[model samples]
Target: MNAESIAIVGAGVAGAAAAVRLAERGVAVTLYEAVHEPKPIGAGLLLQPTGQRVLAAMGLLDEALALGIRVDRLFGDTPSGRTVLDMSYRRFHPEAYGLGLQRGALMGLLWRRVRALGVPWACGAAVESFQQDGDGVTLQLAGGRTARHAALILANGSFSRLREGMRVRQSARLFPWGAVWTVLPAPAGFPQIELRQRFRSASQMLGLMPVGKAHAEDVERGINVFWSLPVASLDGWQERIGLQPLKQRMTDLFPEVEPLLAGLTEPVQLREARYADVHMARWHDGRVLAMGDCAHGMSPQLGQGANMALIDAHELSAEVGTGGTGGKDDWPEVFARYTRRRRAHLRFYEQASRGLTPMFQSDAVVAPWLRDRFFGWGGRLPYIHQQSIATLAGYKTGWLWGRLKL
Candidate 1:
């Protein structure tokens, strides 16, 4: 192992991005992954302007744009055709738009950058735990193997066991609700540039987002379809509720989605996803630093999971530039500064996601009623509308303060 190299656990978005950025700056990075072959998980996601800037900085934005659908607006309505939530990226800037992409496409882009930058990969090397020594951290990988590095970065997913030993004050709670998602060929007449959704109160919600082809050479574009359900129900959804009933219910709420749902034949077509809200008092402890979902995971209501991870990678690289003469003694300062730079931005999104999730995904009767009755009007006021758009664009750093220029 290189003595000056940083060890990044998990080759997901955050870890891979960090490795690429650090390597681009002439710093040595070793990316570790638990899986023997690293691949993207999940279905599709929206790339906010904030995340786009990070990709642009990494020189991968153009490729990402080519593989993604340009989403101009997010529109959600009730079964009775009442708009509950409507937000547009154009409201923030004339040229601003969100990119809806398959998660695999984004991962493929980052993996290519990883290879191009010559970042070392340690496959099947999951770090089970770590101990911070005097000026370095010793990682204890699975199968009793060990490796030591000058500094350690934990970018493992939200359910990472590595986070347990960090000794930082943290809390992880599984949200009661989650969604089952699948990618299907984009149906005809479906708007290619809008993320359209339908809701029947808080219990039922469905969304369709046009995600362009996974590869540039692919002939057909695709759309990501997701339906909300309680986490407990997901276990037996296939046998208990069955696909036909689910499809019937979905078509009943949003008839336009009927054509898309027709493609679903088996329950296995949809992949279930549950979310967690992770809060940490601080992101760093000694020579070990945690980033991405490992540090601060939250609900997907705001579509900021991958974006926040990308930003964390960008900021961390900016803080610990090139691993120059700073050496080992500077890592604590680097970690602290990175945490400070990210605290407000992460907090605002965490709070906002928590506050907004129940209205869209819970079983509460009054909450959805209130949302349908007032959210549209609240979204119409000039100042609120602009701020809402800013938040959606991932520019808000604080509730009333802080906006990042992209």
Candidate 2:
């Protein structure tokens, strides 16, 4: 669009990254946030190649690499003393490795870039509603203060009211199981080269990601722990059963986590999170374009949530095709092109994550049984194992299926 300033709702990974890119390209960008001070929530996340490419494009990959722990392998242990996941990044490329990092660290990096570029962030000002016309989009803030921009980018979140207002259709489903996560000092003896998980069954899984440190905060050094827990059974952990039993379960499942327990003081210290798969038919309508979680948030089972969000910001720039200079105001053409280019990639992850979450966290009695019995061996095959690694690294699209026609 020839119009200069762009209104980006949500100061999240998607919005922040897009803002930084757009601003650097000389497009006037204003990021609106609901919170008085926006901060990243959640524990650790893995930055796959797909995500790193985006950071590199934005000239921040080196900084991102320095802020997080380097992860080269993904190893898992099952209740029966069997290793279910034993994949390594080396299989994909000799130097390729996923970076395990605090979610806040990455978001902070993006926000810092946004700030450096002089992109104005309207914090504490919630965009209550928005209006769109043939020319530009107008954002109505909480206090009725309105600002108009050439285009609207929605990265608010999966629970975004703006996405609802856009009338985008989707089949959203919540996973029965979620996670309770906490950050603990990385145990001196803990290996930081891999993202590890211990599982007793589908319902009992513990993911321990070595998230190095936070550069801007006092509490810099730590690892992230996420335990699989069902929503229906959460009250029991808080009231009826108590954390003592859960603590005992931790010791039995993976004694290695014992060193990290003292830092957790109490179960109440950990926060719970639920994941949902929002399957939208498209990610845009009119001048309003949706990206990240609000458009297509998927389960973290495959560890692609943040990566996909970052990639969305990258691909979006291409579809927006502003060329570092304002272009046409053809909203329909821009939105349609973005959707077409991103659909295949989005479809793969949504399907892969949905298909695999059950193997790790679910009430399905036979699912876990089948996983422990077959997954270990199946994951060892050269071709199958390589495919799994590709999926893990966010290269699933062109790995095997791109050339085939259904």
lDDT of each model, Cα atoms only? 0.88, 0.81
Candidate 1 lDDT, tens digit per residue, 1-406?
7756899998989999999988886778899999997766568999899999999999999999999999999999997888887898888899999999999999999999999888889998878888887778888899999888988999998887788888799999989999899988877786798998899999999988998989889888999998999998987899878899999988988888878877788888989998888999999988788898888888787889999999998888788753465453378778888888888888898899988999999999998999999988899887888998899888899899798643
Q: What TM-score fits each model? A: 0.97, 0.93
Q: Worst lDDT window (10 residues) for model 2?
A: 397-406
Residue 366 of model 1 has an lDDT of 92
Relative to the true structure, candidate 1 reaches a TM of 0.97
Residue pairs with colliding backbones in model 2 are none
What's the lDDT of the predicted structure labeled candidate 1? 0.88
What ranges in model 2 sit over 4 Å off? Answer: 1-4, 216-220, 235-237, 322-326, 403-406
Tens digits of per-residue lDDT for model 2, 46-135: 899778888888888887787888899999988668988899999878988998878888987898899889888889989989888888
